[model samples]
Target: MNILSLGRSLASFIVVYGGIDLVAVHAFAPLRSLSADGLPRRRLTSRFSAGVDLKQNEDLQKYFQAAEERSLAQFARDDAPAWLQTIASLPFECTACGKCCKTIGSVYLSSEETWQAAELMNISSTEFIEAYASDIIRDSAEASNTWVRLKEKEVLKGTDHSPACIFLNSDTNQCQIYEARPTQCRTYPFWPNLLASPDAWDAEVRRMDHDSESTLLEWTPDAGGCEGMMILDQNSTTLGVPMKDVYRQLREYRQQDRYFPTGDKKADTER
Candidate 1:
């Protein structure tokens, strides 16, 4: 490589040879000779001729190209960088694996929502409570804060507590009362509780249900950490309109406080 080809008043670069860093120490001694590895040393004077020979040296060419790329990525404005945009889309899409609907905490709805859901199903509120819901006190301070809690059935084998929501269709793995579903049902995995960490996108920690519970781990801590997550790209679904509607409903459910999870007083726990 012609190091002095770059006509400049002052220039500095490191030439890597045999894993050793050889630098031009001074104008008098442009480079230190090292013949231990059978590589001839370079010595060139720093004199300006208004010409740059970065193209001749592949390493220098790559260095300047990478430097230019980094500057653009760091300084460009008005829009996010390409990599940032890709990351923003991450841990967000719900493939409707229906896992969240199945493996979930208690699903509750306001009294108004209960009535609306009941009416949509062409049933009286009294019958709805008896068949699908139970009354629960939302707040202990006042007796007026009562909400309807949806029941869960079809417990996952080997786990007593893991049950699918009662409204979930066993045949299609889709919500039966999707349009008329409760507000709580409307705001699903989007719950502030799950937003505490990006890691929670797996629908509850690193264990994203490796197909079957048996393959979760194998004689080691954090062994299956790389397993795929529950959420997926919106385009990953092939269920057509039904699946598309579910994603559309979720996007509409996003509230102003969607970024914050529960426990922060400013966060609106109920969407």
Candidate 2:
């Protein structure tokens, strides 16, 4: 039975790798409830699922993308919907499948995040901007804080690839300014918090879900620490636990003050 019909929240179950104690990281609110006749019914819009309000405007894209990543990571858990309850009970763990980070698309950086990245390199923001940040219209439909950094740049000479990010230390394959990295980068592999609609979600799911003989299975991790693997682990299953409330809590959690890569008190956090 579709858990949505039974008034259950759809959650993504996740298993972290490298021998960490399993803790339930992300979950959603129940979407349906059981009926008296032993069947499930969809919760009404007024009280059922929180309607997803997708933002397509370019100005909001990065912020939206960050949110989408967090949300999708939350949903990618093995405990998320579609997986049976039995699978949910199993102690799942990520295998460090770095497929999520390699060959990744653009990772947007906010003004504050950009500045912090510069500091990590012990360079001024001006220098960093000259080296990396470029004003580009990522989306014409909206006025986003659009900036692009190259990762995996095709060498002008022999076939060598490098990332656009100055903070990426080649030997370590890690972000030098991870504490201050952009929210989008922090929340890789799961981007639905930025792209809201289920339809958009369906597209991403189709893009990432590995099938036999799929080229995606051959992918590699972009960096060390396997942080994004956490995201991939989140997306790996469909346990369909209720996650709306969980997301709200996470959003609230982001409000607390913390040191970022660029500097302190760099972001408003409310956004």
Candidate 3:
């Protein structure tokens, strides 16, 4: 389908299956970031429904590629924060050991995320929210806002049940709905806290290992130890696009006012 058709289809699917209002879709449309080439970015916004398979859509993939480049350029800025600079200089590769999936705290879900996940699961949005999420109050810079977080399941070993993400498969140590996972899950190692410094990253790795009962894996400043993990440099890497860039692009979607409930001034008071 053409870009306009794709956008319309996504918008219609959300309204029809996800039960989102059209007005909300229009409000979110303007948040699409401009590509580095000065073209508008084609992103899957809040209006996107769960049924569209992004993997099969080549145009969508190109859009994602453009968006990734835009995110990477941000890190090259002279005024980039220290944390971002630290991350840019380091090489990170997900071992796919599922340690983060098993150990990290709750995965918060936005309203858009809830709907998309529900559609991916072939269930109603209300059903998905009811089954997987719980309400929590989050204190933001402005005020406390109510949000939903994905519920955790207990990893049973004999008699004890340890906390783990509900979507994590204990037997395989992988995410069940990885493709539809929330943005929080998608941006794993690049989290601001972990990128604070080398020591902070080491601390986070240690915590993940401890929580998931995995062997202690040390982080080497050089790219030598891990087999599956790729050493990301500006050149000479054949591991496709680096995950750091992909995660940053995914993160950009959340850094917009449209992602949150800005219309509800009472619930989300501006500072």
Candidate 4:
């Protein structure tokens, strides 16, 4: 190979596998110093969600690819706590499954989304905050920026009972306030956690399919955990949806969460 090609390869190797300082020092020249976790040393707003900015740096992309590969290898042996594994074999297709909504502490609405839901319900945001939302954070900049709690009602099904969103009708299993649902609810099944890897995908999806409080396998293969939902043969992402479209959906979701935090305050100004 040519000297130029060899140098480029060496730089890529140093960034990915090589440890210590000298992260992405090829063209940019010390854009980031090596941190304890081998990630870039900076006051990062986010690690993976900022797709646009992250993609601009070629070295970061290669570093992510290498890290993901290593994690997948570790997962093969450990098969526990499936973290850092990327690639959700197929795109997620939400069947309006209320399983996710039933889980406690699964949904939290942003400040702006909270008021929008209130207006739809004909209740003022003040009243809604008093009744529906919970004060998780107070006396801080992020105070009320997030941490709106929805109604958690207990519902009986035949022989068992499960916690569900107050808006979820037990008989029909449909969201009452679908139009006014928060961004977290709207971007179900495609959230970064769900898209980490196929194992995570199956574990999350199937666990939701169960009626009981789903628990991950703790001891052995046959242990206290969800077993009702069968391991699906996810041949294609949903049926007709393309992979690109799914990625695009996730990108849009991230962008919306990043740009429009409170509400459409700029809606009138833009118009």
Candidate 5:
């Protein structure tokens, strides 16, 4: 390859590897550094749900890719957890409850999302940025980086109290941006399940009901079909939706939680 091409490749390798190293170092640091497991964790805010913070676990790809690659065959072999089985069997359809969309979170836009949203609204990306970007100052950085959140429930001088989602159309209780909706939304129900940590699973189950543990454990493998869900692994990502990409999106929110606490005033801001 040309010198320029080789140099670019090396730069990319450095950025990715360096970032991975940083993530690995911090993965267990908080738990170890403070010597307090009671440290407050980031909770879900707005209309968005939180998932695994893969940035904290540089090895996350191995597990997620495993789920994507192996079929239902390997689930039992790997000693996969029961939550995946329970979710696979449960009828967890969205039901278009609109419960989720009504209270939206600060929506982070992907590069593609930014472009598409601009196109859909027939507005310049700059205009979109001005209207929806959330200001975040990274502690590691001197200057603030621009990020976007979904518009609040109320905009347009109080005339539009509708959910500010460009994709949310309450009239139909549907996401106009459904197909293009962030990967985060598509992985619901299975998310906290796919995350598969015992602590994380227990906490989420407690939200749905206090008595879910026994049932969740029983449904994991032999009886229910959720074992099939565990079939997702790296190879699966290659064929369908990339699991790493989804985890990356969730990781951003996870990492941001360090700075933004749950139930903070900003979360309660009137739409």
Candidate 6:
């Protein structure tokens, strides 16, 4: 079927799956605090997984939290010319494997992204937020606020239960709002976790492989991570340059508390 047909079908499926309801969205408003060293520690609550011993999962959760903290630190240092050089030198390409979308935890939505996605889905922003989004409490020394992000759905795959972004269509393994996807979704593979250091990038490739077997076996960690996918030369590149620009914009957005441009000429010109 065509793209429009697929979108309509997916929309119908979403509604049937109760995506139109406002009460179903899971809120992750756990009280979070940052340590003296600037690492975030989230309080365990029933919202994550009910009827389970959080004590048993504490260590695992801490490890994942530390990884996020490390990535944030890397993002702080992204402006370094040497780091930019390293990023430019690395070889990379997206095969549209959809592995990242499947593996990532949450797709944080800025206010602009939320509105745009709602429009694309042909729904009011309030309805969209009620059905598909939730508020995440972020506490830090510099900023303490709540941000909206897409909710995850629990899907049973064989004997395992996997968490995926609500917009991910399980049958086709494609995003429903690809054209109007959030900046976080648009700026994948160039994330701080994958660009922090050579070792970090290598680790991410391994992690991706472990998460999704569809990732090519040839894209090994030792070969500089996603070997064939990387841009070998700076000349004649598209994604690489745009990704760098995105990286810069993300930094600016964080520092200035401003929304990224939505590429709407009329809207942007009006602003």
Best by TM-score: 3
- In model 3, pairs of residues that clash are none
RMSD of each: 23.7, 17.8, 9.6, 14.3, 14.6, 20.9
lDDT agreement with native, every candidate: 0.44, 0.36, 0.51, 0.48, 0.39, 0.48
Give the per-residue lDDT digits (tens) of candidate 3, residues 91-176: 55566766565443556666655666787799997798788885543446435333466777855578544466788888988888
lDDT of 5 by residue, 1-271 (tens): 4557545543443354443432243342221111112111222111112233333434443443353334223432344454333332322223464434544444555434555566667788778667655543233342233334555445566563544555567678687656445433544434433356534423332112234544443221112222122233334323423333333323333433334333233423312
**Better candidate by lDDT, 2 or 5:** 5
- Give the alpha carbon lDDT tens digit for every residue of 1-271 in model 1: 3556432212434422222232212111101221222122232222211233333556665654454344324332322222222332334344565655654455665555567678779999778888987444354554544466677775657865456678888788798877666545554544434433444444442344444565343212212122323433455222222322222233323322232223233222222
TM-score of each: 0.42, 0.38, 0.54, 0.48, 0.39, 0.48
| Separate clash counts for every candidate | 0, 63, 0, 0, 17, 6
Clashing pairs in 1: none
Task: Report RMSD for candidate 1.
Answer: 23.7
**Greater-lDDT candidate between 3 and 5:** 3
* Candidate 3: regions farther than 4 A off: 1-71, 83-89, 136-146, 155-161, 206-271
lDDT of 2 by residue, 28-60 (tens): 111122122111122222222243211322333
Per-residue lDDT tens digits for candidate 6, residues 38-124, read 222232232233322325645434544565445544654655334555443344556555555555355666554577688889999
Greater-lDDT candidate between 2 and 3: 3
Of 1 and 5, which scores higher on lDDT?
A: 1
Considering TM-score, which of the candidate structures 2 and 4 is the better prediction for this target? Answer: 4
Model 2 lDDT, residue 39, Cα? 17
